[model samples]
Target: MRLGSVIKVKPEKLEEYKRLHRNVWPDVLKTIKACHISNYSIYYKDGFLFSYYEYKGNDYHQDMAKMAADPKTKKWWAVTDPCQSPIETRNEGEWWAAMEEVFHLD
Candidate 1:
């Protein structure tokens, strides 16, 4: 399944955010893969960060829950979350607002 989300980057921390992502920790990467998330990529523009990833797991919620329950992933988010501003448009419980798939071919 293809998933997408959007969040805002604090203007002052854009460079630092990019730098941190450029060197994402190995354990974090491993955890993500272990969760069956692939083809994950984050793009930045106009102070907004958009993330897209393909979930190849049998259960999306379970996989995501597993990832969230990981210690290393928690540490990683502690560092990264400070640089982000949850968009106001996001749902009540979402740090990154879920985006709808408008169109896709193939």
Candidate 2:
């Protein structure tokens, strides 16, 4: 499955966000892979950050919970979360607003 999400990057922390992602912790990367997420990528434009990734696991919710429970991942989020601003319209409990896939080919 493919998933996409979007969030706003604080203007002042844009560079900091980029820098942190460039050197994402090894353990965090491992945890992401362990959770069955791949081809993960984040793009920035017009002060907004968009993320896309493929999920290979059958149990999406369970895997996501596992990812959230990871210590390194939690630590990574602590540093990055402040650099982001959740969109006002984002659903409750969502830091990055989930996006609907309108179209895809291949």
Candidate 3:
């Protein structure tokens, strides 16, 4: 599985952001599971929200398309997406900026 990261602004609408994640509407969770993503998590520091996820499926694009097709995910994005701003230099058609994994020692 490959690792990925994306960035977004700390929500100015703090309460709403917190509320949505605190509950994470059931369908959203279902969508995640259906996509074959696991150990997903998000963190915030220095006014930036960082998301980390692992993809286990054979085709990431197809899996994500499944995610995008979900009505619940679409609704969830409508509410949460406004809280983020993509990095200026991030490539087009990409939501979160990606990080390079230079070395792994295990």
Candidate 4:
């Protein structure tokens, strides 16, 4: 499976981000699924957000580009984008930092 990661910060206000994600927009959900992504998850630590997604196709970069071009994805990003910060240490075009997998218990 292909893997990807993203980062977002804890909102300055109370429970705003959590609430928004609790019912993510249907169009946004559809856009992600259309991109051939599945088994998605997000985690938080030390006030940093980490997202993981698995892809099941050969054309990852092209699919990601399509996802970015989607209007729904753009709208979703407009809302959730403010909650994120790019990792300062990553190379350019890296919005999320990649995590090195150390172990897999499962």
User: Which prediction has the highest TM-score against the true structure?
Assistant: 2
lDDT of 1 by residue, 1-106 (tens): 9999999999999999999999999999999999999999999999899999999999999999999999999999999999999999899989999999998887
Q: Candidate 4: where are CA atoms >4 Å away?
A: 2-14
The residue-by-residue lDDT of candidate 4 on 1-106, one tens digit each, is: 6464656585583266677788999998888999899988877777677777788877988988999999988988888777777777766777787776655555
Model 1 TM-score is 0.97
Score candidate 2 by lDDT: 0.97
lDDT of each: 0.95, 0.97, 0.82, 0.77
Instruction: Give me the runs in candidate 1 sitting further than 4 Å from their true place.
Output: none
What digit string (tens of lDDT, one per residue) describes model 3 on residues 1-106?
7576667675676556767899998999999989999989887776676777778898888999999999999999999888788877678787888877777665
Number of the top-ranking candidate, with lDDT as the measure? 2
What's the lDDT for candidate 3? 0.82
Clashing residue pairs found in predicted model 1: none
Q: Where is model 1 poorest over a 10-residue stretch in terms of lDDT?
A: 86-95
By lDDT, rank the candidates, best first: 2, 1, 3, 4
> TM per model?
0.97, 0.98, 0.88, 0.86
Cα deviation at 100, candidate 3, in Å, is 1.5
lDDT of 3 at 16: 67
After superposing candidate 2 on the true structure, give the runs of residues whose Cα lies further than 4 Å from its correct spot: none
- Tell me the deviation in Å of residue 88 in model 4: 1.2
- For the record, the alpha-carbon RMSD of candidate 2 to the native fold, in angstroms, is 0.5
